[model samples]
Target: MKILVVDDEPDVKDLFEQRFRREVRNGEFELAFANSGEEAITYLSSRPSEVVLILSDINMPGMSGFELLRHIRTDFNAPPPPVVMMITAYGDPESQQQAAKLGANDFLTKPLDFTVLKEKLRTIA
Candidate 1:
């Protein structure tokens, strides 16, 4: 599995690398990082068709995850990646519903619990 992680914080990317290092080491998964939604989209758009999942932060400078979700839904009219999960510190009901409406596969709260997230990914993977 290839998981494209989109977060503005460099530290968050480092933490994710730390957390998922074993998976990468074992060759079970590969991870990529994008600092913003636009960069994420650009990276994915130009990729060699290998991304299976997207883990995105909600609030971003250029494009929010909600808008990114909308963009994927609209732009990927045919076959698209089936897994796109939103991660946010601000997890309100309204935002959750909005994310769901925008076609997010899952919404995860910040200070993430990797155990649970892994279980969810198992279902998708």
Candidate 2:
């Protein structure tokens, strides 16, 4: 699976790589990182069909993940992946509800448990 992870934090790429090392090595997953939502959009625009899933953080500088989700739901001419999971440090009910309303396939809170995330990814895969 080719997964795109969008976050503002610089270290996120390394974190995901470390957490999903075995899956990456075994060819079960291919991870891509975008430092911002704009970058993610650019990546997707060029290769819309490549990404199988998107894991995006809700809080970002220019384009919030919620906005990104909305864009993906509405703008893409090609059918992008239906699975977009929103991740955030804020796990409030309102946040969760908003994500669902915007068509998120799932919601995850930060300080992420990769074990649970891996299971979810497996189900999707």
Candidate 3:
């Protein structure tokens, strides 16, 4: 499975790599990272169908993840749109509701729990 991880934090790539090392090494998953919403959008535009999942941070510098989610839902016309999982440090009810309204596949809290994330991915895969 191919997943695009969008976050402004530079260390996120390393963290995810460490946490999912086995899966990555075994070729069960492939991950790509984007530092901002604009970068993520650019990647998506170029490789619309290459990614199966997107894990995005809600509070980004340029374009917010919510806005990106809206654009994805609007622009990506594939029959089975890529699953978007919104991640936020705030974890507020309003954000969660908004993400659901905007068509996010899942909502995750920051300081992420890899075990839970793995379980969720298991269901998706």
Candidate 4:
């Protein structure tokens, strides 16, 4: 499976790599990174069909995750649209509800629980 991770934090790539080392080594999944929503959108536009999942941070310098979610839902509505999971540091109910309403497949709080994330990925796969 191919997954795209969108976050402004530079260390997120390393963290995800460390957390999913086994999966990466075993070729169970391929990971891609984008530092902002604009970057993520550009990447998706080029290869929308390649990614099966997107994990995006809600707060960023530009083009917040919610906007990205809306873009994906509006422009990429092809059958089996890529599954999107939104991550935010602020675990507010309103943001969670908005994300769901915007078409996020899952909403996750920051300081992620990788075990739960893995379970969700398993179900999707």
Off by over 4 Å in 2: none
lDDT for residue 39 in candidate 1, whole number 0-100: 89
Question: Against the correct fold, how does model 1 do in TM-score?
Answer: 0.92
lDDT of 1 by residue, 1-125 (tens): 88889998889888888888887898877889999989887887787357888899999888988887887777643475447899999989999999998888889999899989878776777
Candidate number with the higher lDDT (1 or 4) = 4
User: Which has the better lDDT: candidate 1, or candidate 2?
Assistant: 2
Per-residue lDDT tens digits for candidate 4, residues 1-125, read 99999999999999999999999999988999999999998998898688999999999998999999999899875778899999999999999999999989899998999999998998998
TM-score of 4: 0.97
Minimal lDDT window, size 10, model 1: 73-82
Output candidate 2 Cα RMSD.
1.2
Error of 4 at 11 (Å): 0.3
Q: State each model's CA lDDT, in order.
A: 0.84, 0.91, 0.93, 0.93
Looking at candidate 2, what is the lDDT of residue 124?
90
Q: How many residue pairs clash in each candidate?
A: 0, 0, 0, 0
- Per-residue lDDT of model 3, residues 1-125, tens digit only: 99999999999999999999999999989999999999998999999788889999999998999999998899874867899999999999999999999999999998899999999997887
lDDT of 1 at 120: 79
